[model samples]
Target: MRLLITNDDGVHAKGIHALCKELEKYHDIIIVAPDDQRSATSHSITIAKPLIVKEVELPDIKSKAYSVSGTPADCVRVATDQIIKDKVDMVVSGINIGYNLGTDILYSGTVSAAVEATLCSVPAIAVSTESSAEDYVYENAAKYIKKVIEVAVSNKLHEDIVLNVNVPPIKDEDIKGIKVCKIGKLQFHHYYKETGKEQENLVYKLEGERVVNHVEETDSYYVDNGYVTVTPLHYDLTNFNILKDVGKWF
Candidate 1:
């Protein structure tokens, strides 16, 4: 299979590198990633600026890698529309440094990249590692991702659904098991503090850490408890249950 891999963490990230190394064993891989970290840039495209693409070489991975001056979604779009052009069999995003779970998916570039691929009618998966430390066990995450990808390819998941996988930071031996779950309702409080006064205007910035999620069955909780969480996500954002009621209100 020909796989097109991308990430929001940029071309030089160890996560993507590890993923490419593991994936290259069984499939032909091509990587197109942001030139710099674009985390939380969800499905954004570079419209005003001219997007640039350049070929790059990594240490051990022998796949054809490209660096893009855009968000994760742009990389997938360009890789499918221009670079590979209908030759791609699958699209895999991330092996991200941090977890993207629950409501956080709205701000995640990792999930957006996979969503973009699914929109193009290709199967995709978004993989993330839940680690508080700056450096994570990317090799283990990559191995697990490779196994999941093999299963996905063999079983052929629904085209409209993308897998959002979050792995714990623990060693492989410490991991409990993988769980297929639904997206749980988890939220973080946003706090701001006044930084300075600029030009007679009060300037404030985000201050305070993310709040601890209270939900028990959430992906966040599973990761916190050393279990890999696999959530199947769809592209449609419609609230079908409220459609008729909303229409009446309008």
Candidate 2:
């Protein structure tokens, strides 16, 4: 199969490198990733400024690779529309350094890249690891990603949908199992706050930390508890239930 791979953590990230290594044996892979980390840049495109692309040299893989000076979403858009020109059969993003689950998906560039591919009518998967430990195991995550890709491609998983996968940080032996789940409601604990004085009528700096989640049976909960969470995401954001209520209000 022809595969297009991308990530939010930039081209030089170990996660993407490990993923490429594991996947190189099975598919014709093409990597187009951001030149720098754009972790929380959700579904954003570079429209105001010109985007640049540069070829990168990797040690083990013989895949075609390019680094783009844009967000993860931009990488997919450009790869499909400009670089490879719809030649890819599927899209996979990440093996991200940290998990993208529940509410975090709203801000995850890894999921956003896959979402962009799904919007372009391709099956996509976003893989992440729930690890903050410096010595966290990534090989398992890579291997799991390869398996997911194989299953997805062979089953011809819905083209207009993307899978958001979160792996536990523990060793492979410690993992309980994989769970197919729905996107559960999780809320952040904090909000952005300005840290520095305004400069030229603009806020100079902002910083914040996420608030702890309050819900159970969520992707966040599963990851926090050492289970791999697989949430299928769709491009449609419509709230069908609210349409009638909104119509009445209108």
Candidate 3:
């Protein structure tokens, strides 16, 4: 398969490098990622300003690479729409430095990059690590991702769906197994704290505390208990059940 690879953690991130190393052994891979970290930007594109793209040299891997001065979604949109000349079989987004599970994925640029691929009528898979924002265990996550890619390729996925994967940060042997599950909660309580004032205006930063997902078989619970999780996700936000109920009011 010819795979277009990307991540929210920037072009030089270890996670993306490790993923390309493992997968390039089997598939033709290309990297188009943000020049800097663009985490949590979600589905945003560079509409107002012109996006800058540059071909870059990635050490130790030979696959063609480019760096985009925009969000992760911008990388995919520009790459598919303008950059790569050949057809892409799939968009494999991330071995992201941090998890993008549950509700937090709505704010995740890694998952959103794959979502952008689906909008382009291409199949995609977004994978992430359960590691904290800065952890050095990406190769482990990358190894599992290669397997997931193999399975996904053998059995094609619908363009409307993306396989969202989250791997626990552990040695390969210690990982219990892969679990196919539903999305779960990332934060139980959410709030913001006033950090300081910027000149005359008050500045605030969003904060949240996580609560365990006691519900079994969710992505949260499985990863919390040492299992790698894969959840089928779609971009459609329509509330089908409420459609008919709200029709009577009109």
Candidate 4:
């Protein structure tokens, strides 16, 4: 399979490099990632400004790689439309530096890249690690991702879905197994702190402290308990059950 790989952690991130090294063994891989970190950029595309793309070489990987001066979604857009000549069989985002579970997916550039691929009518998978540490291990995550990719390639996945995978930061032996779960709702406790004041304008920075609430049998719960969580996600936000009731008012 010809795979287009991307991440929000930039082209030089170890997580992306580890994933490329593992996946390249079986599939032809092309990486188009941000030139700098673009985490939490969501599903935004660079339409107002011009994007800059440059070819880059990473050590120990023979696959073609490019560094994009834009968001994670931009990398996918440029790769599929311009950079890669072959048809992309699959789109895989991340092996991200941090977990994109629950509500975090709403603001995650890692998952957004995969979401963009699904919008383009392609099967996509978003892989993330459950930590923010700089030296988190990715060998186990890479192995798990390879299996997931194989399954996705061999089986017929739902047309309207994309897989969101979160691997815990545990040792290989500590990993219990994989869990196919639902998207959990996690409440993050955050606050805005005043950073500066320029003339009459005030600047504030938003800070997320921690997860205050997490539902059971969710991606977050499973990942926290030492299991890999795979949640099937889609772009449909319509409330079908309430549609008929709301239509009566009209």
Measured against the true structure, the TM-scores of the candidates, in listed sequence, are: 0.94, 0.90, 0.94, 0.94
Q: lDDT tens string, model 1, 50-157?
A: 899999999988999999999999999889999996578889999898878778788899999999999988889999986444444788888888888877878887
TM-score of 1: 0.94
C-alpha displacement of 187 in model 1, angstroms?
4.6
lDDT value, residue 140 of candidate 1: 86
Superposition error at 120 for model 3 (Å): 0.7
The model with the greater lDDT, 1 or 4, is 4
Ranking by lDDT: 3, 4, 1, 2
Q: Compare candidates 2 and 4 on TM-score and give the better one.
A: 4
Highest TM-score model number: 4
Worst lDDT window (10 residues) for model 3?
Answer: 130-139
Cα lDDT of model 3 by residue, 64-146, tens digit = 99999999999999999899988988999998887877888998999999999999988999999855544446887878888
The pairs that clash in candidate 2 are 189-211
CA displacement after TM-score superposition, residue 217 of candidate 1 (Å): 2.5
How many clashes in each structure? 0, 1, 0, 0
By summed lDDT, the worst window of 10 consecutive residues in model 4 runs over 130-139
Please give the lDDT score at residue 68 for candidate 2: 99
Which candidate achieves the best lDDT against the true structure?
A: 3
lDDT of model 4 at residue 71? 96
lDDT of each: 0.87, 0.84, 0.89, 0.88
